[model samples]
Target: MSSSFQANLDEDYIPQNILLTGGAGFIGSHVAILLAKKYPHYNIVVYDKLDYCSCLDNLDEISRLKNFKFVKGDISSPDLVSYVMAEEHIDTIMHFAAQTHVDNSFGNSFNFTQSNIMGTHVLLEAAKCHRGMRRFIHVSTDEVYGEGETFETEAMNEEHVLEPTNPYAATKAGAEFLVKSYHRSFKLPCVITRGNNVYGPHQFPEKLIPKFTNQLLRGRPVTLHGDGSNTRNFLYVEDVARAFEVILHKAKPGMILNIGGANEVSNLEVAKKLITILGKEDQMDELISFVPDRKFNDLRYTINSGKLHQLGWKEEMSWEEGLKTTVEWFTKYSGRFGNIEDALVAHPRIGFAPGSSVSNEH
Candidate 1:
């Protein structure tokens, strides 16, 4: 169906139609669903490339909504990007499309640069051409700040200098610079968000939480890297979505905000928490297997969200509660993760399904 939110000749401004890139991925999907439900009058167009980490099923709930539409396309293509902005009558842009896996980036830095840096540049150029756009929300990660020695006592804020250690983080930092440059040179109204590690439903199982949980369910050892002391703040995906909503509506042009969860837990603690939530505490010691760490694993990641909190945004769920909910989701969907067809659909890049015959070294 055609979008009903068209600009009226008598109105001074056009109705908002948000173009949400990477809406098939974890955080983007959650934010897309929230936007559809919260803004019924505004059109929410989801643009995703459907990479191995992304699934259209993530948007199944909101796909049928009158205000929601999905377009399968890549942001790396300027023609497609420009066409989408025009066809969707997009007035707002949420650029979340990026290759985010650090380990994968080490092996394939070109892919990271293609999607994260070049794609972001293409999208920003497209956004620059759009007239009267309300705001362009650039979604970024705390990893862009890399690691800090003072993470134990201090948190990285918006002013933290970029010192990316990995290729993935470097590309993201480059993208953020491009966003700022567009805002400066083209006067494109824009804002940026640096969020902490987010966990929730529909997350691909390759990440730490889901990977360990899947290993436990399959009676396999949960691989712990470097004695598992690396710490990270875990923000629930729904909370991240809510923060995006607040930033989209209330943020000033050119503002750089950090969206973070106050929960600072270590990698080993996260595994133990999952075991406790899954009632597999008896196998705790046996379930964990210490492995060689990543070539350059950051000791910890902590970020200050004071600016976001000042905008009336705060995390509603504790990390424990969120972990329980996430574990339950995996339990309900365990059969699918075990099935070949479903696993292939979820992880197309891997030669074998997650829990299948192939071993997951990472």
Candidate 2:
């Protein structure tokens, strides 16, 4: 066990039982594994609907741990959520489940609303009823802040206005409001963390880093939306997982913290770097092509993690090293790449179809 794991156990801060929604997915699975290994005395119960985006193989490493348990249930299912909360003696709720893809949200806003907004409502209600629960951590994305002319320089403080551009971001913003409402009205002890792009091992290949890396490895053309000049700060998955752990363990209640990487890079640059690292430079210029940009794609997304850093938490991974590790992981799991491409096709960029309004709440 790592020192962090031992410290969590020693501090007696381990919530006898933790309820992690979407625990079977990428980031959630990594977080669950860390929590389970560190505090073997605590029971960690994962509740997930196992949607098409989620793969059970992500949790294979932690499945055998005596401290880890999984419940196949959606957060939208009131009865199922309530039952699991009570049965698991869950005192800490880590809400990570949601429809996270922005492109998918373009044509299917309803599904995004259902899963991200309505689903979050279900979880908040259950937490309200679970009088035994102590902490509720709402994992959100920085997209809720919308795109700006320049990168967010001051680090998006909790007071940042909600300006979600895409359907996925809009629903996430709505969910964050609900969490705050619960904290204020229901007196729910909730903390929210808005993290930037997360990339690392076990990440579904549909994401840019994994998707492009897999394509390069397989000798396929890597598609770049727009001119691929959009800048985004990428946080390594393990760093993201650690950010949650730090926030849950040390941060104060009712605070929203921005967790981001130290470096920001453009999409085209990221693609070129990946190809270079893979020694596939010959295919770099030829394979990389800019497709039509997604509807309402943010131009630049950079977050300041000064607040998280002030709380003694800092991102430890560099973009270069992180990308290298991500490439290695995706190469090892190349078999799963086919499934990712199929998943990507399901959400074609229909680009602001009827009913998607430009003037709307974030």
Candidate 3:
């Protein structure tokens, strides 16, 4: 498939049954809804494990759509995956279900390996067996590139070497290799997408943006890790979803693409901006504190999405605009966020060990 054809899929030119593995999660849910709304004729099935981070509420708007279907299952369950693929006549598989939290991965590296790496193997096997399956798009992250000096220079491209610093990123990088190997050795049609830090509505409070928003709204201090110098490129969830849509139709077998907002910000700067946006500038001094950083924390991650851009796609949202909108949404839905006490209790920063336990507070 050429990028031109993929770009036109939005017009319902190439109709195919699509399977979204983590359709109930933040980015997946948004992508599912976009497909349902734009290509109403195509079948859109959501296969999710309904993990704590995934909420059905995220799919509330599209659940009633005629072309939408929801299946509660784990990607690691080959039997379930095979059953769904056969029954749904799935042609394209969007693999997004995995243990995503870096901090959580530290504490339980086994879970990360099982879900991110092993689960992908199961999915690849199923895709290979399914008769009509044409493409498998593996959603990945920029962290796979690990710490680098290129963050401030040209964005890291597909040619960058894989050096995942955390268990979560390592698992994702492993999954990418598996996909590439399957495509090369077995001739499985697959494309890998490395996206930047995504934030927006429906995101679990464990992530940085949402967590900080929730804490500030509740008058709690937002913890900053290691002097807040670590920088990350933030992309809105919707933009990331759109990139998937673009790649699903356009990318050829064995292709890898990078997607990012092209905007980078440090943790300290982000916290200060959020505090100002929320009109709590006076509390900034007390609300932000630098704690020990994660183990082997990658000081920077930035992706050069020139490949995707050359394919005729670019991020449509800016961080400043995206952040304000995100803050507004979290504030509007403050009631739904509930309390962060449990999240804090479940994963504490005590012992100050990096790479020891994956922090739920992304």
Candidate 4:
């Protein structure tokens, strides 16, 4: 918006050295591996605090690549982030590090605020001061838009107002405010993307899909919040990774796009589907247990992803294919994070300090 703009929107964005925060986590790791392997000439630096939900094993595919490097640190640490920026000569930043569990956020809203809002501020400040910074791609969630009316008719777009319904979503909205301010004031090139629920391999079982699959695999009751009428558009993790890859090269500065998915399913439907996929359809009635809902559970979250589709990114994984692959992966590798019994429960109100992570989790 100003003459001091750091990037030229007219030209293709070229990132020689990139920083991917939370790159060891589920979705972030997929993006990290894809970028590291796809862009051989680009240096991919992963900076993460290795929180309870993340594992270094997620990045094994790219660990041996010469262009890939890993750094363990918190984004809220100004000194460490600055050090990495200087050492890596980072020109682009894809911010994905944040405390993302809604249930956990209820018990630990302060941690969510610190990691999602304050930590994002620290990265924004670092990017602003770095002269080589060309672009800042912020990875956000569809929850920021709160609950949508319906997938068939009431899908929200990038222009919709943000009304986050939970502590986790609220903190994400707070971070978006800071990103927008940096873009308008300092002209630090920034683009934001709000993505749907992601399900695939390596996802911690705290979320719905993987959690249900694992519960069924272990012969435990699949837990559902409330009557299970809540609906969410599910995108396979790799499809989401491809969306980022598209945005990384094609998105213009100051643009905000919604990466919605076509596979919209209700919580009840998902639980039943997982049961059938896991060969427990006979016990579907007994395996699914309704639990108390969250402090506030949005009924549905549907967003219009036409903008991202226009950028050459579209959902490729069918629901049948994605769900089957996810169930199979966890059936064999359910111990990826060791015993995940804690994460299989309906609601785990995890308690952790602001800007700090716990050593143990589900």
Q: Choose the strongest candidate by TM-score.
A: 4
Cα lDDT, model 1, residue 19: 90
Residue 341 error for model 2, in Å?
Answer: 2.8
Give the TM-score of each candidate: 0.89, 0.90, 0.91, 0.94
Backbone clashes for every candidate come to 0, 1, 12, 0
Model 2 TM-score on a 0 to 1 scale: 0.90
What's the candidate order when arranged by decreasing lDDT?
4, 3, 1, 2
lDDT of each: 0.78, 0.77, 0.78, 0.84
Q: At residue 97, give the lDDT of candidate 4.
A: 84
Number of the predicted model whose lDDT against the real structure is largest: 4
Candidate 4: regions farther than 4 A off: 1-11, 150-153, 350-362
Span of 10 residues, lowest total lDDT, candidate 2: 353-362
What are the per-residue Cα lDDT tens digits for candidate 4 across 21-114?
9888888889899999989999999998987788999999889999999999999899999999999999999988888878888887888888
lDDT (Cα, tens digit) per residue for candidate 3, span 1-362: 12122333334225389989878888888889999999898899999887767778889998899999999888888899999999999999888887777766677678778888888999999999899888888888888888776555566788888888888899888988899888888888888888888899888777788878887887878878788888887888888878877787667767788887777889889989999999988877998977777776677877778778766677888788999999999888765635555443224444422221111112
Ten contiguous residues with the weakest lDDT in model 3: 353-362
Encode model 2's per-residue lDDT on 176-280: one tens digit a residue: 889989999988988888888888887666678877887777787778888988988888888888877787777656677888777678989988998899998
**In model 1, which regions exceed 4 Å deviation?**
1-15, 151-153, 335-362
Ranking by TM-score: 4, 3, 2, 1
> What lDDT, from 0 to 1, does candidate 4 have?
0.84
Worst 10 residues of 1 by lDDT: 353-362
Runs in model 3 deviating more than 4 A are 1-15, 150-154, 335-339, 344-362
